[model samples]
Target: MALFDDLFIRLTSRKVGRDRFGNTYWEARSRKDAYGRPLRRVTYAGVPEASAVPPEWWGWLHHTTDRPLPEDAPRRPWQKEHRPNMTGTREAWRPPGHDAAGGRRQPSPGDYEAWTPGR
Candidate 1:
């Protein structure tokens, strides 16, 4: 199935560009969306997570910009590189009291009371 899909894309789309993460973007050779824009597509380089795409490519993929930002685009000193969403991965953040981190949490400051049914 994957083989056929790859062949279909190869036959029907043209490579637009690749992101820093190695994901390749494509545009259908003969297809257009409702807006009359060439239909855009992406072939994931690895895990197929959408968040893995960088901002420039994201803008192009969504039709927000005519083209993906150039590789030489200006960057600010504080700019950070893109990182994929890690919500379920081992690298995902875990709060101090999260079971994955440890079953212990910091003590409360005692400024509040537990809710009671009659209160």
Candidate 2:
């Protein structure tokens, strides 16, 4: 599937921009999506996950903006660098009680007693 997309992009799309993660963005020269917007796509540098695209380019890719944020655009002081989804990776977050976090759940207070079978 990627092979076909690559061929199509090479033949018909123009390079829009690339994100910090090295993902390349492209738009079709003449093709458009069902919504009549220009066909946009991203060729991920690694995994083909949607999260790989940063918020900066997301708007442009979805046609929400005419162009992606400029390369030199100033980031807000509180803005952090974009990171791809890590749900299944080793660096993924695990809550304290999760098995991967050693399965040591906190104990609850002994407030309620179990009901007796015939009580």
Candidate 3:
């Protein structure tokens, strides 16, 4: 959707943070709205894809956390970086035997046997 948002306004708004993908986060500098509630917003890097937002920033955007992830926090080996959803796109993954791969899984030898008559 097209919005008539003024570039000057965005330029002057409080610069919250920038994610790895270049997405810019913002919060009202005034800290509170007319109703005395906190204001937060995120300007996506591109195309405004929901999945494009990383988990850490997402938590802050959604008010799940009072602050974004600490920059100095050590990352665990088991933790993985976030990636946008790729479902239905060419980048999406398909298993080896999937119909899109033009192949079918072959049954392993001795995996099964037909029962004729008991010997």
Candidate 4:
């Protein structure tokens, strides 16, 4: 974090809320911009990766909603925790047969057949 931004955030922003994944959302202390339009910002908790921010907060950050989604909003029983982008990292997904994992694919003879025009 640069000195100016650190000072600005500390002086001019207030905590709106934090999501389940630990991302923090903020709003300008003085509501509305110089042109009298709404303004807001977000301070990513860790690596500053945008993908880590939840969908609801992403919407609010982009002004899709006036209210930031409640931090502890109820979730469906089937819901899974959000995962941040792992591209270029060892933790990234490597599907079966992926070159990074191995060049060999599981044999599935019945999975495909060349089309025959004259049956």
Candidate 5:
């Protein structure tokens, strides 16, 4: 066992719950800090990767939802599951008129205006 694990087991209270990614949470039962003042603490175990948490879990962790997402959250026949943003990737945004295969067509004549220095 790791030194931290050994120390954590000896010092903290009981294990609360674990997420699907193997991250565990431990909540202090006795409300007391090192100085004996009433305090609550939550300890996280495993690699602390924020992205590992799903959107529903994120909402619950931030107290946005009182209940953890249902084990079998409803999915409509037409609804699609959530996907991470990919705006900056190679497969990202391509406007309808932009070139994807080869040279793009020039802008139409009505799309331009003659600029005057004074105006």
Candidate 6:
């Protein structure tokens, strides 16, 4: 299981930094692809669930940051942190007209339609 061992080594190495969710990040010590051509790379450890990473970390992971999240990163006093989409979760929203809620109260009597599939 060298693949797993390599990942464990990379994740626990002192050169890597760990995020709040225990995700690890490390810069490629050398600028070269596996084929040995010059290239830049960053590696991530742990599940790739987007929700597991915070917004600031997400930006850094995508090369938007030359430096890791700063200690002084501005945050408004009233600002709330990002939460992942929960479309299928218990907390997910169900609009008033959705079938889950028995759909919009039946359309008014005058809204009746006679279907003519071909016409």
- Given candidate 1, what's the lDDT at residue 105? 94
RMSD (CA, Å), candidate 5 to true, equals 6.9
Better of 5 and 6 by TM-score: 6
Cα RMSD for candidates in order:
2.4, 2.9, 6.4, 5.1, 6.9, 5.3
Across residues 29-83, which tens digit of lDDT does each residue of candidate 1 receive?
9999998999998888887788888888889999999989986799889988887
* Winning candidate number (TM-score): 1
Alpha carbon lDDT at 59, candidate 1: 90
In model 5, the clashing pairs are: none
lDDT of 4 by residue, 32-88 (tens): 967675567777667778788887787888887888777577988997778878898
- State the lDDT at 109 in candidate 2: 85
Q: Flag regions of model 4 displaced more than 4 Å.
A: 20-22, 29-37, 106-119
lDDT of 4 at 73: 78
lDDT of each: 0.87, 0.85, 0.76, 0.78, 0.54, 0.59
| Runs in model 3 lying further than 4 Å from the true structure | 1-3, 6-13, 29-36, 106-119
TM-score (C-alpha) between model 6 and the true structure:
0.57
How do the residues 20-94 of candidate 6 rate in per-residue lDDT, one tens digit apiece? 656655555445556664332233345455676766566665666755685357998986775656878877888
Error of 3 at 68 (Å): 0.5
TM-scores for all candidates: the values are: 0.80, 0.78, 0.64, 0.68, 0.43, 0.57
Off by over 4 Å in 6: 1-16, 31-47, 71-74, 105-115
Candidate 3, residues 1-119: lDDT per residue as tens digits?
13544353375467779888888888776667666756777777678888988877889987789888874578899977777789998889988778887778766588687878975
lDDT (0-100) at residue 32 of candidate 1?
Answer: 98
Worst 10-residue lDDT window for candidate 4 reads 33-42
- Indicate the worst ten consecutive residues by lDDT in candidate 1: 1-10
